[model samples]
Target: MNKIIFFAQTRELVGVDKLELAVDQMAISQLLEQLSLRGNKWSLALKEKTVLCAVNQTLVNYDYIIQEDDEIAFFPPVTGG
Candidate 1:
Protein backbone atom coordinates (compact mmCIF):
# COMPACT_ATOMS: atom_id res chain seq x y z
CA MET A 1 0.00 0.00 0.00
CA ASN A 2 1.05 3.58 -0.61
CA LYS A 3 -0.02 6.89 0.89
CA ILE A 4 -1.27 9.49 -1.55
CA ILE A 5 -2.10 13.12 -0.91
CA PHE A 6 -3.96 15.61 -3.06
CA PHE A 7 -3.35 19.30 -2.48
CA ALA A 8 -5.11 22.61 -3.08
CA GLN A 9 -8.14 22.27 -5.31
CA THR A 10 -7.35 18.64 -5.87
CA ARG A 11 -7.68 17.92 -2.16
CA GLU A 12 -11.03 19.67 -2.02
CA LEU A 13 -12.24 17.78 -5.04
CA VAL A 14 -11.29 14.39 -3.65
CA GLY A 15 -12.94 15.27 -0.30
CA VAL A 16 -10.23 13.50 1.67
CA ASP A 17 -6.89 14.47 3.10
CA LYS A 18 -5.23 11.24 2.08
CA LEU A 19 -5.76 7.76 0.67
CA GLU A 20 -4.12 4.38 1.14
CA LEU A 21 -4.17 1.80 -1.59
CA ALA A 22 -2.69 -1.65 -1.94
CA VAL A 23 -1.23 -1.89 -5.39
CA ASP A 24 1.40 -3.85 -7.24
CA GLN A 25 4.57 -2.05 -8.11
CA MET A 26 3.17 0.59 -10.43
CA ALA A 27 3.98 3.82 -12.18
CA ILE A 28 2.43 7.16 -11.26
CA SER A 29 0.14 7.04 -14.28
CA GLN A 30 -1.21 3.67 -13.16
CA LEU A 31 -1.79 5.08 -9.73
CA LEU A 32 -3.80 7.95 -11.17
CA GLU A 33 -5.91 5.57 -13.23
CA GLN A 34 -6.64 3.50 -10.14
CA LEU A 35 -7.50 6.57 -8.13
CA SER A 36 -9.76 7.87 -10.85
CA LEU A 37 -11.83 4.73 -10.34
CA ARG A 38 -12.18 5.25 -6.62
CA GLY A 39 -15.47 7.12 -6.90
CA ASN A 40 -17.31 10.17 -8.21
CA LYS A 41 -15.12 12.66 -6.41
CA TRP A 42 -11.92 11.33 -7.89
CA SER A 43 -13.47 10.82 -11.28
CA LEU A 44 -14.91 14.31 -11.39
CA ALA A 45 -11.82 15.87 -9.90
CA LEU A 46 -9.56 14.53 -12.62
CA LYS A 47 -11.85 15.52 -15.43
CA GLU A 48 -9.89 18.69 -15.89
CA LYS A 49 -7.77 19.00 -19.01
CA THR A 50 -4.56 19.04 -16.99
CA VAL A 51 -3.31 18.24 -13.51
CA LEU A 52 0.12 18.07 -11.95
CA CYS A 53 1.68 15.30 -9.86
CA ALA A 54 4.56 14.99 -7.50
CA VAL A 55 6.29 12.20 -5.58
CA ASN A 56 7.60 12.76 -2.09
CA GLN A 57 7.56 16.56 -2.53
CA THR A 58 9.64 16.31 -5.67
CA LEU A 59 7.93 17.04 -8.97
CA VAL A 60 7.83 13.97 -11.18
CA ASN A 61 6.57 12.95 -14.57
CA TYR A 62 3.94 10.29 -15.16
CA ASP A 63 6.49 7.50 -15.63
CA TYR A 64 7.83 7.75 -12.07
CA ILE A 65 7.81 4.38 -10.29
CA ILE A 66 6.27 4.24 -6.84
CA GLN A 67 7.09 1.78 -4.09
CA GLU A 68 5.30 0.73 -0.94
CA ASP A 69 4.36 3.57 1.39
CA ASP A 70 5.46 6.29 -0.99
CA GLU A 71 3.82 9.70 -0.63
CA ILE A 72 2.40 11.14 -3.81
CA ALA A 73 0.51 14.38 -4.25
CA PHE A 74 -1.62 15.71 -7.10
CA PHE A 75 -2.21 19.40 -7.62
CA PRO A 76 -3.04 21.96 -10.22
CA PRO A 77 -0.29 23.88 -11.93
CA VAL A 78 1.10 26.94 -10.17
CA THR A 79 2.37 30.19 -11.57
CA GLY A 80 4.32 32.85 -9.72
CA GLY A 81 6.97 35.44 -10.21
Candidate 2:
Protein backbone atom coordinates (compact mmCIF):
# COMPACT_ATOMS: atom_id res chain seq x y z
CA MET A 1 0.00 0.00 0.00
CA ASN A 2 1.07 3.51 -0.75
CA LYS A 3 0.21 6.25 1.72
CA ILE A 4 -0.70 9.60 0.22
CA ILE A 5 -0.96 12.73 2.32
CA PHE A 6 -2.27 16.21 1.53
CA PHE A 7 -1.54 19.39 3.39
CA ALA A 8 -2.42 23.09 3.48
CA GLN A 9 -4.61 24.37 0.68
CA THR A 10 -4.14 21.16 -1.23
CA ARG A 11 -5.87 19.27 1.53
CA GLU A 12 -8.73 21.76 1.65
CA LEU A 13 -9.19 21.52 -2.08
CA VAL A 14 -8.98 17.76 -2.25
CA GLY A 15 -11.22 17.29 0.80
CA VAL A 16 -8.96 14.67 2.29
CA ASP A 17 -5.96 14.74 4.56
CA LYS A 18 -4.64 11.31 3.68
CA LEU A 19 -5.44 8.12 1.88
CA GLU A 20 -4.06 4.70 1.12
CA LEU A 21 -3.68 3.34 -2.37
CA ALA A 22 -2.98 -0.18 -3.43
CA VAL A 23 -0.18 0.63 -5.83
CA ASP A 24 3.17 -1.05 -6.01
CA GLN A 25 5.23 1.25 -8.18
CA MET A 26 4.31 4.24 -10.30
CA ALA A 27 5.66 7.63 -11.26
CA ILE A 28 4.47 10.68 -9.33
CA SER A 29 2.97 12.13 -12.47
CA GLN A 30 1.04 8.95 -13.10
CA LEU A 31 -0.26 9.01 -9.55
CA LEU A 32 -1.39 12.58 -9.93
CA GLU A 33 -3.17 11.68 -13.15
CA GLN A 34 -4.95 8.86 -11.42
CA LEU A 35 -6.08 11.09 -8.56
CA SER A 36 -7.30 13.74 -10.97
CA LEU A 37 -9.70 11.22 -12.40
CA ARG A 38 -11.45 10.96 -9.04
CA GLY A 39 -13.56 14.10 -9.60
CA ASN A 40 -13.61 17.78 -10.44
CA LYS A 41 -12.19 18.81 -7.09
CA TRP A 42 -9.33 16.37 -7.51
CA SER A 43 -8.61 17.59 -11.03
CA LEU A 44 -8.68 21.19 -9.97
CA ALA A 45 -6.46 20.60 -6.99
CA LEU A 46 -3.95 18.17 -8.51
CA LYS A 47 -4.02 18.91 -12.24
CA GLU A 48 -4.71 22.63 -12.40
CA LYS A 49 -2.74 23.85 -9.44
CA THR A 50 0.98 23.50 -8.79
CA VAL A 51 1.83 21.54 -5.67
CA LEU A 52 5.08 20.33 -4.23
CA CYS A 53 5.53 16.60 -3.72
CA ALA A 54 7.64 14.45 -1.49
CA VAL A 55 8.24 10.74 -1.31
CA ASN A 56 9.27 9.31 2.03
CA GLN A 57 9.85 12.82 3.42
CA THR A 58 12.29 13.76 0.64
CA LEU A 59 11.15 16.27 -1.92
CA VAL A 60 10.92 14.89 -5.45
CA ASN A 61 9.76 15.75 -8.90
CA TYR A 62 6.96 14.28 -10.92
CA ASP A 63 9.33 11.79 -12.49
CA TYR A 64 10.03 10.12 -9.19
CA ILE A 65 8.84 6.55 -9.04
CA ILE A 66 6.86 5.58 -5.95
CA GLN A 67 7.53 2.25 -4.32
CA GLU A 68 5.28 0.07 -2.22
CA ASP A 69 4.57 1.37 1.28
CA ASP A 70 6.09 4.71 0.33
CA GLU A 71 4.69 7.78 2.01
CA ILE A 72 3.76 10.48 -0.47
CA ALA A 73 2.87 14.02 0.54
CA PHE A 74 1.47 16.93 -1.47
CA PHE A 75 1.37 20.52 -0.38
CA PRO A 76 1.48 24.01 -1.82
CA PRO A 77 4.79 25.79 -2.15
CA VAL A 78 5.97 27.48 1.01
CA THR A 79 6.25 31.25 1.01
CA GLY A 80 8.11 33.38 3.50
CA GLY A 81 6.76 36.66 4.68
Best by lDDT: 2
| Model 2: per-residue Cα lDDT over 8-59, one tens digit each | 8889999999999975578889889999999998888886348889889999
lDDT against true structure, model 1: 0.78
Residue 73 in model 2: shift from native, Å?
A: 0.3
Q: Residue 11's C-alpha lDDT in candidate 2? A: 96
- The alpha-carbon lDDT assigned to residue 37 of candidate 1 equals 90
Model 1 agreement with the true structure over 2-76: per-residue lDDT tens digits: 778887888898898787776547887887787889898897776534678877789888888887777887888
Task: Mark the regions of model 1 whose C-alpha exceeds 4 Å error after superposition.
Answer: 47-49, 79-81
Q: Report the poorest 10 consecutive residues by lDDT, candidate 2.
A: 43-52
Error of 1 at 23 (Å): 3.3
